[model samples]
Target: MAAWNLYRHRNSDGSSKDWAVRSNSDGSITTRRGKTADSLPGVSNRYGVKQFDIERQKQAKGYVLVGEVDIDVNGNVVFPGKTSATPTQLPEPDANPMSVPAPPVEALYWTVDCHAKQTIRVELGIEVRRLIGVIQSVSDQQSKPEQDWDGWQQFIDATLNAETFELSGQIKSVHGVLPWLFLLALKAKSFKGVEIDIATETARDLSVDLKAEQDVLVFFGTDLDSIRDTAEVLGLLKPRLNLAATMSDTDDCWF
Candidate 1:
């Protein structure tokens, strides 16, 4: 909140210059003693959070778009405003040609990361699948026809081959224990892919709901000492259990 090394260069005529710079406590440089600060307005870091709210921003900042699909002619599947589809069947020298309109279809795969220790709520949009079809004309110069089944098959192939997505968020809390443990659980789990759903419905506008369910463990402790003690006992017991050797003693085993 302090300004540093403010200066005004004076000419021999004793006129003052109009610029200044300031150093911020967070190791960030900022302009202070100049018209820039006054003209720009809202130049204070006072509204910023004291620490990073990892959970609050996790879902808000992360999303992965997997792939794109193209729409074919049953009609033009124009995004907003576009014209109608053209005829696919070609004209003949001796007979009339049949025409059909083509429609557009596509789906995009996405991964959303929710950043929060407390639960978050959100509204998700609809999910769609792409239709696959090839372009081929009876003659090389004619318009091509498409089939519904083929298009569906193409969508399947594209979605299946879509790349895997991983999303992470930084959350800040006075106590870092819960956050650290949650991260460790993610590392221990093995999943081909995961679907996460977290929500926070109340305080709609003021609070950003950032919550997600994952394949890994999610533990938040009001009582960390108890859980830590239990983990130590279990850790010691696991390696000592070898039941197969005890049961298979061939020398003189009588059970």
Candidate 2:
């Protein structure tokens, strides 16, 4: 019945934290010292045996249980056919506290699922693509007299403004357009409910993932006049990319 006597780290005031337990090739169990984590056993005899009076012995010294694992009767720390659960052993900190590595940052991400409103999304996508094409065509056909970039840009902006101009567009619409509708409303003078419900949800989820390292501002419009951003612009936010997705499909695309 030999097993690991897990011990967690706690503050002097008895608050608990996620410090790793210490185990060795031998059946012995111990814990690291206060304030340091992922380190080797700093305090000796911290882990107490469950089968004997060892639990009382360690508790007397203020050790807390974290978890446990079964050991073999041979007393050679029989690792139960499981992958190594040992936490990574951290090296001693440098004399300069700042020299120590910063704790790993949990990646923040945001997910926008528009599967429910695929019909509207595809429609919007088609219109947006068409408008984008018109803009590009106008820009490239500078030598042509028929090109009308300004008119085309205004048309797209007006279209986007009419169909889905603000955050309420998503909330008020049949389906949730979310970031699509919400981001547009930002250009408005003043609006409400942006920070509530879906908006706050997006923030709490930390789903702001993008290929670029800098912040991205995605604008859904028809023209590129004010598109080429300044120092404030990190990158243009694009639509949700699907693998092998077509540029435009009669059934899939709206325009």
Candidate 3:
């Protein structure tokens, strides 16, 4: 016979929002605009299968969701709830914000399973072996040697052989070709700085291209999900590096 209390307001502009009632205590009220504790009790949440499907597509195209708004923790949302319900908790941010690697990133381990097509399975990771670059010889100039024949050959050999590789001293296996396919993987430290780009083709092929850098990492595959998952883990942006913002404006775009 407990009464419902205002736990938090869930609104973009802040009007009457959701509420949660506590069995004991005065109960808590939260504003859809207000800030929640950095550390809230963790809760198990699940996204609709359809939503996850959309996420896969968006990520495949190189988009990411890094911000959350109008969130409520420790609130009762279920209808006609009883007193046994527990408070919701927010996920913990990386302990060392700068040090914590991105969740999904290029050239990283990823396992993907498609519900609709059980036959679709993908595993992505870095290759442990490294290959030295070599040039390809052309028999006839009429055939016109590939623009990047050596580079391309090196790319193919490394990518195929990259079934095993190393990154940051971590040993990982490449399940198969990756989404955002790259001809090869190489260290790009030779360049002072570089911008990275991730792309997908009509054939469902994945490609990652790091520009103007001698050393780089490449992933070749058809699984767009794995490419995105890799980018998410490696912290590399599609053709760019995404910087985290500390503030935002009315449009919700971080500034």
Candidate 4:
């Protein structure tokens, strides 16, 4: 008898495929792959670290471990915690993507456009106050009541160095910081009301005029694909469509 580890990869469109791997008694590894309902054929030509490498490759391709099962000499699958030899069915696609749990925090990342350049300046007196307010609002929504204020203040005082009473930076130089500027622009809906100004002096300047509210939205919509996650974190927006997929669909028009 050989124990097999099963994995399944579900697509956003509700379709899925199943894969299984097991080590043979003779020190070789056998793997099977096919649709959930299909009788998957096994291939066993590799040995040693190849099995582990294949597992990692499948996981990288978005396959998730389902469970372990044993295959007897008679080719019957003994599912753990179940008497049935039938494989588990793939889950239905989520109609509301937001209902799916967020990716691990460590997996979250800010997307930056390496080619774009712009210098943004936010007036200290009014804009910084509003920025702080927005940060506080986000922290309050995300953090516990007892820790929100302190966390917000420490982030402002230590990480941002906003005590200088002004905020200005080159977008290209600090691409990760684009989300903060985007948040400010997103909240105020205009650069003037927030007292935030943008200068595109560099050779590789942004294609959209950041000063214009409509253009700002369009630019963020089409270019800053990952900012949707940040906006969702700030409670300014809800997760709706897959932004990356949407951008890919519109790539021809933009380029």
Candidate 5:
């Protein structure tokens, strides 16, 4: 590993001073500015040089953090950290060019609205029309004490006119045991691969086990890749289609 030592003048202010990396072999600085190598060697180009500045720095060489990085090696290009391999010689291309695999295409992600198509009707006592075990948000999260089943009917009248549905993770003020049973009725009707009998609302949480079914795909909110994969498998999106689209989409909002 060839190296250089930069320096600034012995008598100078810290800011405006000459600096250069002295070739380790020649003892002469390889880089120079205005007044030549006057020895202002505070910071070094590589990480090791910075350490040298801190421990055994000479007054002639002070250090400064600069915009550019300097790698003193010569000839074939050398990557940082790894010192052995030279990038100039690449692995020989496959004799049959067609044998080489193509770069994978981008993935496409699409939001599914199957729940929106499904709705609830109170005409037959708040029965679900489509998917039997679908969870629906009550118009009010907290069922009022004074508000009885009659009030629930009134709530049904005022809200739920639109086809809006609920995501699995929302809970309002406080829900009582009876409301839980109301929601769990769907689970009773839809014992599709569901084995546990949900006697209470708390049981509803564990009644549906996605892992028990071999053909079901369940993704946690954090599992963005699996969700995208499930969407693709269901024909909701094409293979390798990423909604982020741009290479610069660094946000974890999708996750």
Candidate 6:
């Protein structure tokens, strides 16, 4: 019963917050939340399906599963690589302390499940593959495109063609495509960083700034309601969209 699921949300300003959840011996779930390094107090208790629902809610809000720790019966949190005897409280900083360094950003894997009967999954796969193809074409003119071309090709061959595929890299490395995809689903302003003029059929520089993380899973199901649920959790799709709308009327792209 010592297991805990730790989650962290990195802010745009380089700060981060933490959330932790663990199941108690009585089959109830407890959760904690606070800024990184703060001793967060247990904030809530949940049971059964509600526990999972809460977890998904946190994920949708951009909290990524960073790591896990152990909480002893005495309410002591035991972090990995630390001695059990160590005090949980961190020591105070000096009066004239230097700026604390930000933690190293870890590369995250983006996974999309394409093994479904719905055509939306296949459409999503095709869209992603098309983007990769464009990347390949652009890189072909560069001095060192062969390596990158081969790598992206492997991604398509390994995962997109099969049931599930995972793409691993920093968010910036993918040219911020995750957020762009989310924005496209919204259909409010832009597509692929371009402002669309429906009347003119032209594109311009996008005005909105989209944000997303590398660690997430995207799955397209049989209906918009299910897809919207998953997207809302990932913070890709907003809640204002009519859940009753079908895929035919909306943009199709996952992750």
What digit string (tens of lDDT, one per residue) describes model 2 on residues 1-255?
345554444457845433223455565444333343332333443221222233322333344555554433322222356533333332222325455553332211221212224355445545444435544444453333232223234334534533322111122121112232223322121222212112221122212232221222221221332333211132234443445555445447775
Cα lDDT over the full model 1: 0.25
What C-alpha lDDT values do all the predictions have?
A: 0.25, 0.33, 0.28, 0.46, 0.29, 0.44
Ranking by lDDT: 4, 6, 2, 5, 3, 1
* RMSD each, Å: 28.0, 21.8, 20.9, 19.8, 27.5, 16.6
Q: Each prediction's TM-score against the native?
A: 0.17, 0.18, 0.18, 0.32, 0.19, 0.32
Per-residue CA lDDT of candidate 4, range 1-255, in tens? 567887778878987777888866686667777766434554444443235545644664567777787655444556766444654533333445565543322111111111111122223324435656765565454423221122234224422432222223333322233343443444344433232333332111222233343334443333344445555544445567878998888996874
Q: Report the C-alpha lDDT of model 1 over 89-199, residue by residue, as the tens digit.
A: 111122243664422212111222322222111111101120011111111332222322232232233234343322322322222222223222322231223333221
Instruction: Give RMSD (Å) of candidate 2 vs. truth.
Output: 21.8
Please say which candidate is ahead in TM-score: 1 or 6. Answer: 6
For 33-130, candidate 5 gives per-residue lDDT tens digits of 32222222243232112222221223313333222223333422122454432222212223354554533312111110112222332322234332
Using alpha carbons, what is the TM-score of model 6?
Answer: 0.32
Model 1 poorest 10 in a row by lDDT: 123-132
Q: Which candidate is the best by lDDT?
A: 4
Clash counts for the predictions, in order: 23, 4, 38, 0, 21, 1
- Superior candidate under lDDT, 4 versus 6: 4
Model 5 has an lDDT value of 0.29
Candidate 3 ranges with C-alpha deviation above 4 Å: 1-107, 117-207, 210-255
